[model samples]
Target chain A: MHIPNGFLDAKTIAVTSAASAGILTVSLKKTKAYLEDKQIPLISVVAAFVFAAQMLNFPIAAGTSGHFLGAVFAAILLGPWEAFLVMTLVLSIQCFVFQDGGLTALGANIFNMGVVGVFAGFLIYFFLRRLKIKLSISAFIASWASVVMAAGITALELAISGTTPLIQSLTAMVSFHCLIGLGEGFITVAALSVIFMARPDLLKEKAFSKKITGLVAGLLITAFFAALVLSPFASSLPDGLEKVAHNLGFISKEAPSNFSVISDYQFPWVKNKSLATSIAAGVGVLAVLAVGSGFFLVLRGREDGA
Target chain B: MGHSYFDRYRQVDSFFHRLDPRAKLLWMFFFILVVVLTPAQAYTAFLLYLLAVFVLIRLAKIPLKVVFKQSLIIVAMVLMVAFFSIFKGSLEQKLLLIFNVTAKAWLCLLASILLTASTPFELLLKGAQSLRVPQVLITLLSFTYRFLFLISEEVSRMQKARKLRDFGNSRLKHLKTIGHIAGNLFVRSYERGERVYQAMLLRAFKGEINTYSDLRFMQTDVGFILITTGIMLPIFIFSILFTTQY
Candidate 1:
């Protein structure tokens, strides 16, 4: 989401702008190491392509449509650092020329959509590939997760800025984005499948050095624990999981009052809560794959018939 | 493309247009910073800020309707945030939040719109470059600017073709067709990118882009900056005093 100028207070703007500036500086340096003479034009073209692609709307449901955000798409095609640069450029132009986003809030917008979206999406895809997931499936999951994660961060920023309460903003943002993520997942899968069919050569993967991979993994682990530690400040009220459990009448009357790990793993859908959670996750994965491939097959079949 | 879209009034003969792009950019930054940093309770100061912007809009001779339409997006966004504020505070606080957010966002947006409307995009980029922004960023902005219109034209053409094909009514089928169009656009852009690079190389292209500077700071620019600052500083002080008194 593109936060406007007045939506954030001075402290939030300063902190986010500084952080964005730092990250973009680092990205510019990283991009320079690999950006050859020929690749420069490619980067520009890819930036324009992402901008153009964003202008193309596809139907998501009856009387509703969504355009591509292109962060994950760009990261998958170009490298993450270059993708970051491209996103920043696109956002700047949208702000300066089109007045689509605010100038003062550009840093926050860039941080949320460009940096967080690209890195999280790329990391998810990287891990999924390591786990031997198919390319299209990984792309779908990555794109979905990226959008949801960006929304989460946006909610957090709004809450921290005191524009809204943490729990309310988080719940509203997350619930709405769950559906948007589905659209994102489907589009990413469909687009990637087409590229795979049409020009597989363009799908070259960059190999990160072992040291860099280790460093990234370490950073991610630290960030995860940091989030866990800070999560207490997110809301005094029950979290989404707990709220869902309570609403669905999953809490047992005879359950122990102590914070037990087993109780934490409870779900509402079935008697064996932990097993049900696992099964539900599996089923969700299967559903996404089925829908993604079904779309892919229909398109390929149409192409062949034509 | 219509001429009224980007840099619509750049060719107009006005005081704002004649000033150095660098000065206009500095003024924009200053105006935005002041508008954002002003206390939310400073209603008088905000009025003064709006009046100042109104004066600039008049001096620039751009149509009020154009500025208003350009500014409607920011107003809409502020209204959305204001609606969300209803879930948070008491009635008075909610009203205050709405007023503050709307005023600040509107003022900042108007300042930015004035900058773009008065200066050419190329001049803005040149001004940014002269300010020591990174070369890579400038390059990216220039290329994006150069091709954004062209790529958008290509996208519309593709949409027209898709319409002509009588695509199926099914939503799933429509999504697939859109995906195919995106794929084709990407492929075409990639090829075009390579050709453009080759063309540049043939013209003795180096890894760097060089441009000549013709920017000159005149006495009028200094007078404009001084007068604006003189008007804003007193209102800023008064607003701070007025805010603290309550």
Candidate 2:
């Protein structure tokens, strides 16, 4: 689920980076205003807890197990903002120290896991609660929904990065998630039940629920709709409810979109194959050298220039 | 406990280890960009990348046995992806694609390992802080690093305790026990946070946990950055001249 470096293209990296950064800045400010000083240490401790809890492997079937993700768990305990921050911390540490994810793809990982996963759990759980759904049941459903949403978004990113066809990746990713979500749902319900018994006061804390903003809601709906449109490609639906798959099937269909720009013999406008090859080689040389000079400029050229 | 886990070779002093953290970070970042931006079909370029990373690792005085063992993770991932790619292309074409992704990923991981292994966590964070990571994030990260080992130790202790009290083989009950353990840890960690905050407040810890500034972008840093960048042009030239089917 953690996207590695070189898996995503520059465009996908840029867009996801912007989106996650925007949401996080807003979250940092919002949480800061409400919790003041105490939330910082609390968020850090919970982040540590999530890190350690990830080591807790729950048995599923024979010889296979899944670790706790804790996005939804965090959202339920602390508000969505703090949940996002905690996830960001965990994912960032995973990327930097453990190298579990890629350095460049950190933003996409955060967006998929933190923003999409956390918000999905928060909104759905509260919405279910409003309808008088039982607390444990609402948590179960929300956790399942969050995992599924995260899997779908991950497939979307891979497809957009041209790593795989949308239909195939979506089908493979979502189908398995349908089962993984069950595990997540059961564990979340179990954990919440215990917490409810031990520290009911924690469950009752609505740290920051009022300002969910239209941007987040719209992003959720759009992604959910995208998953809906793409889910038909899977061919096996459990029926009744399958509407969040996306229609991002064009990059695969386009055939020569990203690769054409940097293909083995690219810059085709020159019209001669050998000439294009030479020109491409020349450009690579010039680009590399230019970057070299740029690094020198930033690292040393400043002193001389000044 | 995990302190010794990360960058086990940080105590070793070598050329790469002695370079400024900022320079090492920027050079590694640039190296990754070049490796990733190179087309997958550019096998020669990927070879050059592997060579560059190999030279840097050796310069850092880290043993190849350790590095190769760490790289098994990336290799395993590539094998899985390659297996799935069987549906996409012919055996030869699939091999090329697999080689492409594996080489790129392996090279990136090596460069990252070199950077982190050479620089201590504090200096690395200081370098990243200079690169625009927020102070709040830096503080949280340092605290997380400080407590991660303690918390992970706590988790193992609890696991040991649970194992000692093992009863039977009911799978659902097993799952519930794991969940209860996680829930208990969460409560304990939350309270621990309050206690830690009180301690910090007593010590007049405002908001930021600061790392001292000892990093200087020196002459050797500039040389290392440029020489590596200079290596890229020839890699592409060799790649274009020899490897391409043209």
Candidate 3:
């Protein structure tokens, strides 16, 4: 998800920003070593292709449509580093030009959607291929897992920022993304099948060494199970952990003083909090769809006039 | 192609449009940094920031409708977060969360929209180059911008052709067709990339992308920055004073 400004606190933003900057710097240097002059224009063109492809919506169900995120597909087509750069460019343009994502939160957005999405997807694909899974099936699984993992990370960020309770945000983000991931999987499979049929050479060039693939797969499995084990404990007593950290002089004792503007930081104004929230969500979805479609209508009108 | 969605209002002649692209870029970065760093509780400061953005929007002479429409995506996102906040803290806290998030996001979005709406995309890229953003990144961005519309047109053309022959109501069938289109688009794009590389090579292309635009900061650019700083300093002072007392 593209986190807007104000969604994350300063600490989360700073950490993510530094992390993304580091990864991008490393990617730039690594890409420079083997990236031939002939491939320069190709890289730009490929990035534009991804940007355009994202705008191409496919019908998923009645009255609904979805588009490919292209991270997994890009990584499979290009190398992972190239996909990372393409994603970074796309996200940056979306933030700066379209205001689709927040400037302050750009680091988090890029890290979640670009770095995590690309690397996780690539790693999963690599693992599956090593296991002799079909290319189409592996692409599907990798893209699906990538979407879900990115959503989980996004929820973790929100929880760390104290925007919502950890368990609830985690569950909500993961559940909703599960459906989105299915669509992603389908699209990735469909696209990969076609490419495999037509130009298998592109995929061949990007293959990893068997030793490296096995190592990555082992690391991924370990990390996945570790997260599974740690999540419940982390969610149960976040406040307790914070308190302990504060007492140990690791963190400041200050409660978010800036939040004092709201007067009270606990308790709902309405008796039926769930109902109120659902209504608000409905209203927001409707308003956004209406405004978005209206804007497109105006744009179309201008296009016709021109 | 006719709409030029990326630079819809860049041709407009106004103070903001006339300002050096670097100046506008600086204004955008400074405004966003200030807005983000301001404590969420600083309502007065936020209001002042909003006022400043509104003034800039006016000076840019861009249509309010265009700006608001462009901003709706950010508004929608913030609203979703606010909705979640309702299920969490006290009534006051929920309200505060919504207010703080909405104000900060809206201000930042407006500042960004102003920059893009007023400055042409090419100039913005040039400004970014002058700012010494990595050369490789800028090259990717410039190429993406140049080819974005063409690829979009190609996708639309494919979609139109699909609709013409498609009689299938089945979801799976539709997905299959979309997948094929996506595959075809990718292949076409790859081919186009190769042809473009060859063309660039014929023109004595090197790894370096050269731009001919010579961007120079003028007297007014300095004056504009000074004026913005003059306004921002007081807001910063007021926010600090207001926050500390509470």
For candidate 1, give the lDDT of residue B118: 89
Candidate 1 Cα RMSD after full superposition onto the native fold (Å) = 12.3
CAPRI quality level assigned to candidate 2 from its DockQ score: acceptable
After superposition, which runs of candidate 1 have C-alpha atoms over 4 Å from their true positions? A59-64, A209-233, A238-306, B1-4, B166-168, B244-246
Question: Candidate 3 chain A vs. true chain A: TM-score?
Answer: 0.71
The sequence of per-residue lDDT tens digits that candidate 2 reaches over residues B26-130 is 887787777766767776678778887888888899988887877667765575566556444335555656666677777888888777777888788888888
* DockQ rank order: 3, 2, 1
Which DockQ values do the candidates obtain, in the order shown?
0.25, 0.32, 0.32
- lDDT of each residue in B28-60, candidate 1, tens digit only: 887887777777778889999999999999999
TM per prediction: 0.83, 0.83, 0.84
lDDT of 3 by residue, B1-246 (tens): 433776678888988888999998898888887787777678889989989988889988988788887788866666567767644554555676677778878888888888988887889989989899988788878887777778889988988998899875676677677777888889888888989889988998776788797888999999999999899878976896677522
A97-125, model 3: which lDDT tens digit per residue? Answer: 66777888899898788877888778888
Query: Which docking class does model 1 fall in?
Result: acceptable
lDDT of 1 by residue, A37-138 (tens): 546777788788888888877665456566778788788877677888889888888888877777788988887888678877777787788799998889
lDDT tens digits, residue span A207-247, model 2: 44454442344345345435434443333232102111212
Query: Candidate 1 chain B: worst 10 consecutive residues by lDDT?
Result: B85-94
Where does model 3 exceed 4 Å of error? Answer: A58-65, A205-207, A210-233, A237-306, B1-3, B244-246
DockQ of 3: 0.32
